[model samples]
Target: MFQRPGKNEYLESQERYVSLVPAEGDLLTILKEQTAEMHSLLGGLTEEQGNYRYAPEKWSIKGVIGHLTDNDRIMSYRMLCFARGEQAPLPGYDENDYAAAGEFDRFTLKEMVEHYGIVRQSTLALMASFKEDAWTGRENSMTRK
Candidate 1:
Protein backbone atom coordinates (compact mmCIF):
# COMPACT_ATOMS: atom_id res chain seq x y z
CA MET A 1 0.00 0.00 0.00
CA PHE A 2 3.03 2.23 0.54
CA GLN A 3 6.11 2.83 -1.63
CA ARG A 4 8.57 0.73 0.30
CA PRO A 5 11.27 -0.49 -2.02
CA GLY A 6 10.90 -4.22 -2.68
CA LYS A 7 13.44 -6.99 -2.23
CA ASN A 8 16.57 -6.31 -4.30
CA GLU A 9 15.34 -2.83 -5.00
CA TYR A 10 18.53 -1.65 -3.34
CA LEU A 11 21.85 -3.38 -2.66
CA GLU A 12 22.17 -6.22 -0.16
CA SER A 13 24.27 -3.97 2.07
CA GLN A 14 21.32 -1.58 2.39
CA GLU A 15 19.12 -4.32 3.86
CA ARG A 16 19.62 -2.90 7.34
CA TYR A 17 17.78 0.29 6.40
CA VAL A 18 14.98 -1.68 4.78
CA SER A 19 14.74 -3.97 7.80
CA LEU A 20 14.64 -1.08 10.23
CA VAL A 21 11.98 0.73 8.22
CA PRO A 22 8.61 0.69 9.94
CA ALA A 23 5.59 -0.16 7.83
CA GLU A 24 3.38 2.53 9.34
CA GLY A 25 3.83 5.24 6.72
CA ASP A 26 4.71 6.18 3.14
CA LEU A 27 8.15 7.19 1.85
CA LEU A 28 7.38 10.84 1.14
CA THR A 29 5.69 11.26 4.52
CA ILE A 30 8.69 9.80 6.32
CA LEU A 31 11.08 11.97 4.32
CA LYS A 32 9.11 15.09 5.18
CA GLU A 33 9.00 14.32 8.88
CA GLN A 34 12.68 13.43 9.06
CA THR A 35 13.72 16.55 7.18
CA ALA A 36 11.63 18.78 9.41
CA GLU A 37 13.13 17.18 12.51
CA MET A 38 16.65 17.65 11.20
CA HIS A 39 15.93 21.23 10.25
CA SER A 40 14.69 22.02 13.72
CA LEU A 41 17.69 20.35 15.32
CA LEU A 42 20.08 22.42 13.27
CA GLY A 43 18.24 25.69 13.73
CA GLY A 44 19.02 25.91 17.43
CA LEU A 45 22.67 24.88 17.30
CA THR A 46 25.38 27.47 18.08
CA GLU A 47 28.32 28.46 15.90
CA GLU A 48 30.74 27.32 18.60
CA GLN A 49 29.25 23.83 18.52
CA GLY A 50 29.54 23.84 14.76
CA ASN A 51 33.31 24.46 14.94
CA TYR A 52 34.02 21.45 17.12
CA ARG A 53 35.23 18.04 15.92
CA TYR A 54 35.66 14.82 17.86
CA ALA A 55 39.16 14.51 16.43
CA PRO A 56 41.54 16.63 14.39
CA GLU A 57 40.91 14.55 11.29
CA LYS A 58 37.18 14.29 11.74
CA TRP A 59 34.60 16.66 10.36
CA SER A 60 33.26 19.56 12.43
CA ILE A 61 29.51 19.88 13.00
CA LYS A 62 29.19 22.23 10.05
CA GLY A 63 31.07 19.81 7.82
CA VAL A 64 28.89 16.98 9.01
CA ILE A 65 25.77 18.96 8.19
CA GLY A 66 27.17 19.76 4.76
CA HIS A 67 27.92 16.11 4.19
CA LEU A 68 24.36 15.16 5.11
CA THR A 69 22.95 17.66 2.65
CA ASP A 70 25.34 16.52 -0.07
CA ASN A 71 24.38 12.89 0.48
CA ASP A 72 20.69 13.69 0.30
CA ARG A 73 21.19 15.50 -2.98
CA ILE A 74 23.19 12.60 -4.39
CA MET A 75 20.59 10.06 -3.30
CA SER A 76 17.77 12.19 -4.65
CA TYR A 77 19.53 12.48 -8.00
CA ARG A 78 19.86 8.72 -8.21
CA MET A 79 16.24 8.28 -7.23
CA LEU A 80 15.16 10.70 -9.91
CA CYS A 81 17.24 8.89 -12.51
CA PHE A 82 15.93 5.47 -11.52
CA ALA A 83 12.32 6.63 -11.34
CA ARG A 84 12.65 7.91 -14.89
CA GLY A 85 14.06 4.54 -16.04
CA GLU A 86 17.52 5.75 -16.94
CA GLN A 87 19.60 2.82 -18.24
CA ALA A 88 23.05 4.37 -18.01
CA PRO A 89 25.39 3.37 -15.25
CA LEU A 90 25.70 6.18 -12.71
CA PRO A 91 29.01 7.39 -11.32
CA GLY A 92 29.95 7.11 -7.68
CA TYR A 93 31.43 9.84 -5.48
CA ASP A 94 34.15 9.84 -2.86
CA GLU A 95 32.31 11.19 0.15
CA ASN A 96 35.42 11.98 2.18
CA ASP A 97 36.74 14.08 -0.66
CA TYR A 98 33.40 15.77 -1.02
CA ALA A 99 33.36 16.63 2.69
CA ALA A 100 36.86 18.00 2.51
CA ALA A 101 36.08 20.06 -0.57
CA GLY A 102 32.91 21.57 0.84
CA GLU A 103 34.83 23.93 3.17
CA PHE A 104 31.76 24.05 5.38
CA ASP A 105 33.70 25.67 8.19
CA ARG A 106 33.26 28.97 6.41
CA PHE A 107 29.50 28.76 6.58
CA THR A 108 27.10 28.97 9.51
CA LEU A 109 25.07 26.01 10.78
CA LYS A 110 21.88 27.75 9.74
CA GLU A 111 23.08 28.12 6.16
CA MET A 112 23.98 24.43 5.76
CA VAL A 113 20.68 23.36 7.27
CA GLU A 114 18.74 25.76 5.08
CA HIS A 115 20.39 24.19 2.03
CA TYR A 116 19.33 20.76 3.27
CA GLY A 117 15.73 21.91 3.67
CA ILE A 118 15.72 23.41 0.20
CA VAL A 119 17.11 20.24 -1.34
CA ARG A 120 14.55 18.22 0.59
CA GLN A 121 11.69 20.34 -0.68
CA SER A 122 12.95 19.91 -4.23
CA THR A 123 13.17 16.18 -3.64
CA LEU A 124 9.61 16.17 -2.36
CA ALA A 125 8.47 17.99 -5.48
CA LEU A 126 10.32 15.49 -7.64
CA MET A 127 8.72 12.58 -5.84
CA ALA A 128 5.33 14.21 -6.14
CA SER A 129 5.81 14.36 -9.90
CA PHE A 130 6.40 10.64 -10.17
CA LYS A 131 3.95 8.31 -11.90
CA GLU A 132 2.77 5.14 -10.10
CA ASP A 133 5.19 2.92 -11.99
CA ALA A 134 8.04 5.19 -10.94
CA TRP A 135 7.27 4.51 -7.30
CA THR A 136 7.70 0.78 -7.91
CA GLY A 137 10.44 1.03 -10.50
CA ARG A 138 13.61 -1.03 -10.34
CA GLU A 139 17.10 -0.07 -11.47
CA ASN A 140 20.58 -1.50 -10.93
CA SER A 141 22.63 0.75 -8.67
CA MET A 142 26.06 0.96 -10.27
CA THR A 143 27.78 1.03 -6.89
CA ARG A 144 26.18 -2.19 -5.69
CA LYS A 145 28.79 -4.67 -4.59
Candidate 2:
Protein backbone atom coordinates (compact mmCIF):
# COMPACT_ATOMS: atom_id res chain seq x y z
CA MET A 1 0.00 0.00 0.00
CA PHE A 2 1.14 3.55 -0.72
CA GLN A 3 1.55 5.84 2.22
CA ARG A 4 0.45 9.46 2.21
CA PRO A 5 3.17 12.06 2.37
CA GLY A 6 3.89 13.14 5.92
CA LYS A 7 3.89 16.80 6.92
CA ASN A 8 7.67 17.01 6.73
CA GLU A 9 7.73 15.15 3.43
CA TYR A 10 5.09 17.43 2.03
CA LEU A 11 6.94 20.54 3.18
CA GLU A 12 10.22 19.26 1.81
CA SER A 13 8.59 18.38 -1.47
CA GLN A 14 7.21 21.88 -1.75
CA GLU A 15 10.52 23.51 -1.07
CA ARG A 16 12.36 21.28 -3.48
CA TYR A 17 9.80 21.29 -6.29
CA VAL A 18 7.35 24.17 -6.16
CA SER A 19 7.80 27.59 -7.69
CA LEU A 20 8.39 30.44 -5.29
CA VAL A 21 5.62 32.92 -4.76
CA PRO A 22 6.90 36.43 -5.29
CA ALA A 23 6.17 39.25 -2.92
CA GLU A 24 4.04 41.76 -4.79
CA GLY A 25 6.38 44.72 -4.41
CA ASP A 26 9.36 42.77 -5.70
CA LEU A 27 7.70 40.58 -8.29
CA LEU A 28 7.93 42.94 -11.24
CA THR A 29 11.44 44.02 -10.39
CA ILE A 30 12.63 40.45 -10.08
CA LEU A 31 10.95 39.39 -13.28
CA LYS A 32 12.35 42.36 -15.16
CA GLU A 33 15.86 41.65 -14.00
CA GLN A 34 15.58 37.97 -14.78
CA THR A 35 14.13 38.67 -18.20
CA ALA A 36 16.95 41.06 -18.98
CA GLU A 37 19.52 38.51 -17.92
CA MET A 38 17.94 35.82 -20.04
CA HIS A 39 17.94 38.08 -23.07
CA SER A 40 21.54 39.06 -22.50
CA LEU A 41 22.61 35.46 -22.30
CA LEU A 42 20.82 34.43 -25.45
CA GLY A 43 21.20 37.62 -27.47
CA GLY A 44 24.54 36.81 -29.08
CA LEU A 45 23.80 33.34 -30.33
CA THR A 46 23.72 32.50 -34.04
CA GLU A 47 20.81 30.68 -35.63
CA GLU A 48 22.74 27.44 -35.97
CA GLN A 49 23.94 27.68 -32.38
CA GLY A 50 20.43 28.32 -31.12
CA ASN A 51 19.09 25.34 -33.03
CA TYR A 52 21.81 22.97 -31.87
CA ARG A 53 20.67 20.46 -29.29
CA TYR A 54 22.95 18.90 -26.68
CA ALA A 55 21.83 15.43 -27.80
CA PRO A 56 19.62 13.91 -30.42
CA GLU A 57 16.56 13.87 -28.17
CA LYS A 58 17.27 17.11 -26.32
CA TRP A 59 15.75 20.50 -26.87
CA SER A 60 17.64 23.27 -28.64
CA ILE A 61 18.45 26.55 -26.91
CA LYS A 62 15.57 28.21 -28.72
CA GLY A 63 13.27 25.44 -27.63
CA VAL A 64 14.27 25.99 -24.01
CA ILE A 65 13.48 29.70 -24.30
CA GLY A 66 10.17 28.92 -25.90
CA HIS A 67 9.41 26.53 -23.08
CA LEU A 68 10.10 29.29 -20.59
CA THR A 69 7.68 31.59 -22.36
CA ASP A 70 5.01 28.92 -22.35
CA ASN A 71 5.50 28.26 -18.63
CA ASP A 72 5.34 31.96 -17.88
CA ARG A 73 2.02 32.24 -19.64
CA ILE A 74 0.62 29.23 -17.85
CA MET A 75 1.82 30.42 -14.45
CA SER A 76 0.47 33.90 -15.02
CA TYR A 77 -2.90 32.44 -15.83
CA ARG A 78 -2.78 30.31 -12.71
CA MET A 79 -1.91 33.37 -10.65
CA LEU A 80 -4.88 35.20 -12.12
CA CYS A 81 -7.17 32.31 -11.27
CA PHE A 82 -5.86 32.16 -7.73
CA ALA A 83 -6.14 35.91 -7.19
CA ARG A 84 -9.69 35.85 -8.48
CA GLY A 85 -10.62 33.19 -5.93
CA GLU A 86 -11.50 30.59 -8.50
CA GLN A 87 -12.52 27.44 -6.68
CA ALA A 88 -11.50 24.88 -9.26
CA PRO A 89 -8.04 23.41 -9.18
CA LEU A 90 -5.95 24.45 -12.15
CA PRO A 91 -4.74 21.76 -14.56
CA GLY A 92 -1.14 20.73 -15.15
CA TYR A 93 0.65 21.07 -18.48
CA ASP A 94 3.16 18.91 -20.28
CA GLU A 95 6.19 20.98 -21.14
CA ASN A 96 7.34 18.53 -23.81
CA ASP A 97 4.00 18.78 -25.58
CA TYR A 98 4.00 22.56 -25.37
CA ALA A 99 7.58 22.91 -26.54
CA ALA A 100 7.03 20.50 -29.41
CA ALA A 101 3.90 22.34 -30.46
CA GLY A 102 5.69 25.70 -30.24
CA GLU A 103 8.06 24.92 -33.13
CA PHE A 104 10.92 26.77 -31.46
CA ASP A 105 13.54 25.10 -33.63
CA ARG A 106 12.03 26.89 -36.63
CA PHE A 107 12.25 30.28 -34.92
CA THR A 108 15.26 32.53 -34.86
CA LEU A 109 16.93 32.86 -31.46
CA LYS A 110 16.40 36.61 -31.45
CA GLU A 111 12.70 36.13 -32.12
CA MET A 112 12.34 33.58 -29.33
CA VAL A 113 14.19 35.81 -26.91
CA GLU A 114 12.03 38.78 -27.83
CA HIS A 115 8.91 36.73 -27.39
CA TYR A 116 10.07 35.72 -23.91
CA GLY A 117 10.73 39.35 -23.03
CA ILE A 118 7.26 40.33 -24.15
CA VAL A 119 5.61 37.62 -22.13
CA ARG A 120 7.68 38.53 -19.09
CA GLN A 121 6.65 42.15 -19.42
CA SER A 122 3.02 41.17 -19.63
CA THR A 123 3.38 38.99 -16.54
CA LEU A 124 5.04 41.85 -14.69
CA ALA A 125 2.20 44.17 -15.56
CA LEU A 126 -0.35 41.68 -14.35
CA MET A 127 1.49 41.17 -11.06
CA ALA A 128 1.93 44.91 -10.57
CA SER A 129 -1.78 45.57 -10.77
CA PHE A 130 -2.89 42.86 -8.38
CA LYS A 131 -4.62 43.98 -5.20
CA GLU A 132 -2.72 43.83 -1.89
CA ASP A 133 -4.86 40.97 -0.64
CA ALA A 134 -4.35 39.05 -3.82
CA TRP A 135 -0.62 39.07 -3.26
CA THR A 136 -0.99 37.26 0.03
CA GLY A 137 -3.82 34.98 -1.01
CA ARG A 138 -3.15 31.28 -1.43
CA GLU A 139 -4.41 28.96 -4.11
CA ASN A 140 -3.81 25.33 -4.96
CA SER A 141 -1.54 24.95 -7.98
CA MET A 142 -2.03 22.05 -10.36
CA THR A 143 1.71 21.84 -10.86
CA ARG A 144 2.33 21.50 -7.14
CA LYS A 145 1.71 18.40 -5.10
Candidate 3:
Protein backbone atom coordinates (compact mmCIF):
# COMPACT_ATOMS: atom_id res chain seq x y z
CA MET A 1 0.00 0.00 0.00
CA PHE A 2 1.31 3.46 -0.84
CA GLN A 3 1.57 5.87 2.03
CA ARG A 4 0.03 9.30 1.92
CA PRO A 5 2.36 11.87 0.41
CA GLY A 6 4.07 14.35 2.65
CA LYS A 7 2.91 17.98 2.54
CA ASN A 8 6.19 18.91 0.89
CA GLU A 9 5.75 16.36 -1.86
CA TYR A 10 3.14 18.55 -3.58
CA LEU A 11 2.63 22.25 -4.16
CA GLU A 12 1.08 24.35 -1.40
CA SER A 13 -1.73 25.24 -3.81
CA GLN A 14 -2.61 21.57 -4.02
CA GLU A 15 -2.88 21.10 -0.25
CA ARG A 16 -6.67 21.49 -0.28
CA TYR A 17 -7.00 18.64 -2.72
CA VAL A 18 -4.27 16.45 -1.20
CA SER A 19 -5.70 16.77 2.28
CA LEU A 20 -9.01 15.32 1.10
CA VAL A 21 -7.37 11.91 0.92
CA PRO A 22 -7.55 9.92 4.14
CA ALA A 23 -4.35 9.71 6.12
CA GLU A 24 -4.56 5.96 6.41
CA GLY A 25 -5.76 3.32 3.96
CA ASP A 26 -4.59 1.31 0.99
CA LEU A 27 -4.60 3.97 -1.70
CA LEU A 28 -5.18 1.55 -4.54
CA THR A 29 -8.11 -0.08 -2.82
CA ILE A 30 -9.59 3.30 -2.07
CA LEU A 31 -9.21 4.34 -5.67
CA LYS A 32 -10.95 1.20 -6.86
CA GLU A 33 -13.73 1.62 -4.33
CA GLN A 34 -14.20 5.24 -5.28
CA THR A 35 -14.62 4.23 -8.90
CA ALA A 36 -17.37 1.80 -8.01
CA GLU A 37 -18.97 4.40 -5.79
CA MET A 38 -18.96 6.99 -8.60
CA HIS A 39 -20.48 4.49 -11.00
CA SER A 40 -23.20 3.65 -8.49
CA LEU A 41 -24.00 7.27 -7.79
CA LEU A 42 -23.95 8.57 -11.37
CA GLY A 43 -25.19 5.50 -13.18
CA GLY A 44 -28.84 6.14 -12.39
CA LEU A 45 -29.14 9.71 -13.64
CA THR A 46 -31.26 10.27 -16.75
CA GLU A 47 -29.74 12.07 -19.75
CA GLU A 48 -31.92 15.12 -18.99
CA GLN A 49 -30.74 15.08 -15.39
CA GLY A 50 -27.17 14.93 -16.61
CA ASN A 51 -27.78 18.05 -18.72
CA TYR A 52 -29.13 20.10 -15.82
CA ARG A 53 -27.00 22.93 -14.46
CA TYR A 54 -27.55 24.82 -11.23
CA ALA A 55 -26.86 28.09 -13.00
CA PRO A 56 -26.44 29.25 -16.58
CA GLU A 57 -22.68 29.63 -16.10
CA LYS A 58 -22.12 26.34 -14.33
CA TRP A 59 -21.25 23.06 -15.95
CA SER A 60 -23.85 20.34 -16.41
CA ILE A 61 -23.50 16.94 -14.72
CA LYS A 62 -22.12 15.56 -17.96
CA GLY A 63 -19.56 18.37 -18.12
CA VAL A 64 -18.50 17.69 -14.55
CA ILE A 65 -17.91 14.01 -15.32
CA GLY A 66 -15.97 14.90 -18.44
CA HIS A 67 -13.85 17.34 -16.48
CA LEU A 68 -13.12 14.70 -13.86
CA THR A 69 -12.11 12.26 -16.57
CA ASP A 70 -9.81 14.82 -18.12
CA ASN A 71 -8.30 15.67 -14.75
CA ASP A 72 -7.66 11.99 -14.06
CA ARG A 73 -5.86 11.57 -17.37
CA ILE A 74 -3.66 14.60 -16.76
CA MET A 75 -2.84 13.66 -13.16
CA SER A 76 -2.04 10.08 -14.17
CA TYR A 77 0.25 11.29 -16.92
CA ARG A 78 2.12 13.48 -14.44
CA MET A 79 2.47 10.50 -12.12
CA LEU A 80 3.80 8.42 -14.96
CA CYS A 81 6.35 11.11 -15.81
CA PHE A 82 7.41 11.28 -12.17
CA ALA A 83 7.77 7.51 -11.93
CA ARG A 84 10.02 7.50 -14.98
CA GLY A 85 12.27 10.17 -13.42
CA GLU A 86 11.51 12.64 -16.19
CA GLN A 87 13.00 16.11 -15.70
CA ALA A 88 11.00 18.03 -18.29
CA PRO A 89 9.09 21.05 -17.10
CA LEU A 90 5.44 20.13 -16.66
CA PRO A 91 3.00 22.81 -17.79
CA GLY A 92 -0.20 23.60 -15.95
CA TYR A 93 -3.70 23.42 -17.48
CA ASP A 94 -6.89 25.44 -17.23
CA GLU A 95 -9.91 23.33 -16.34
CA ASN A 96 -12.30 25.93 -17.75
CA ASP A 97 -10.65 25.72 -21.16
CA TYR A 98 -10.81 21.96 -21.07
CA ALA A 99 -14.45 21.92 -20.03
CA ALA A 100 -15.42 24.34 -22.75
CA ALA A 101 -13.57 22.35 -25.36
CA GLY A 102 -15.09 19.04 -24.32
CA GLU A 103 -18.66 20.04 -25.29
CA PHE A 104 -19.78 17.34 -22.86
CA ASP A 105 -23.50 17.95 -23.39
CA ARG A 106 -23.27 16.24 -26.77
CA PHE A 107 -22.79 12.85 -25.09
CA THR A 108 -24.99 10.91 -22.73
CA LEU A 109 -23.99 10.64 -19.07
CA LYS A 110 -23.60 6.88 -19.48
CA GLU A 111 -21.08 7.45 -22.26
CA MET A 112 -19.14 9.96 -20.17
CA VAL A 113 -19.13 7.67 -17.14
CA GLU A 114 -18.06 4.70 -19.23
CA HIS A 115 -15.18 6.79 -20.61
CA TYR A 116 -14.27 7.67 -17.04
CA GLY A 117 -14.25 3.98 -16.14
CA ILE A 118 -11.84 3.26 -18.98
CA VAL A 119 -9.53 6.06 -17.83
CA ARG A 120 -9.74 4.88 -14.24
CA GLN A 121 -8.86 1.36 -15.29
CA SER A 122 -5.80 2.66 -17.08
CA THR A 123 -4.89 4.74 -14.02
CA LEU A 124 -5.18 1.66 -11.80
CA ALA A 125 -2.99 -0.31 -14.15
CA LEU A 126 -0.36 2.44 -14.18
CA MET A 127 -0.35 2.73 -10.40
CA ALA A 128 0.01 -1.04 -10.06
CA SER A 129 2.97 -1.08 -12.45
CA PHE A 130 5.01 1.32 -10.32
CA LYS A 131 7.82 -0.15 -8.22
CA GLU A 132 8.22 0.86 -4.57
CA ASP A 133 10.96 3.31 -5.45
CA ALA A 134 8.91 4.96 -8.18
CA TRP A 135 6.51 6.26 -5.58
CA THR A 136 9.26 8.45 -4.16
CA GLY A 137 10.39 9.81 -7.49
CA ARG A 138 9.03 13.26 -8.38
CA GLU A 139 9.64 16.01 -10.89
CA ASN A 140 10.78 19.01 -8.85
CA SER A 141 11.29 21.36 -11.79
CA MET A 142 7.61 22.09 -12.23
CA THR A 143 7.98 25.62 -10.95
CA ARG A 144 7.18 28.26 -13.57
CA LYS A 145 8.77 31.63 -14.12
Q: Which candidate ranks first by TM-score, i.e. highest? A: 3
- The ten-residue window of minimal lDDT in model 3 covers 136-145
User: Which is the winner by lDDT between candidate 2 and candidate 3?
Assistant: 3
* Rank ordering of all candidates by lDDT, starting from the highest: 3, 1, 2
Instruction: Rank the models by TM-score, top first.
Output: 3, 1, 2
RMSD of each: 2.3, 6.6, 2.0
lDDT of 3 by residue, 8-51 (tens): 67778988987889888888899999999999999998989999
Every model's TM-score = 0.87, 0.80, 0.93
Task: Report how far off residue 101 is in candidate 3 (Å).
Answer: 0.5
Off by over 4 Å in 1: 1-3, 139-145
Residues 31-116 of candidate 1: C-alpha lDDT, one tens digit per residue: 88899898778788898988899999999999988898898889889877777667777788988999989999998877888888
Q: Regarding lDDT, does 1 or 2 come out ahead? A: 1
Q: Which residue pairs overlap in candidate 1's backbone?
A: none
Clashes of 1: 0
In candidate 2, which residue ranges exceed 4 Å CA deviation? 1-14, 17-25, 139-145
lDDT of 2 by residue, 11-116 (tens): 4535543345342335566667878888888988899999999899999999999999999999899878867877876687889999989999887888998899
Q: Give candidate 3 misplaced runs (Cα > 4 Å).
A: 138-145
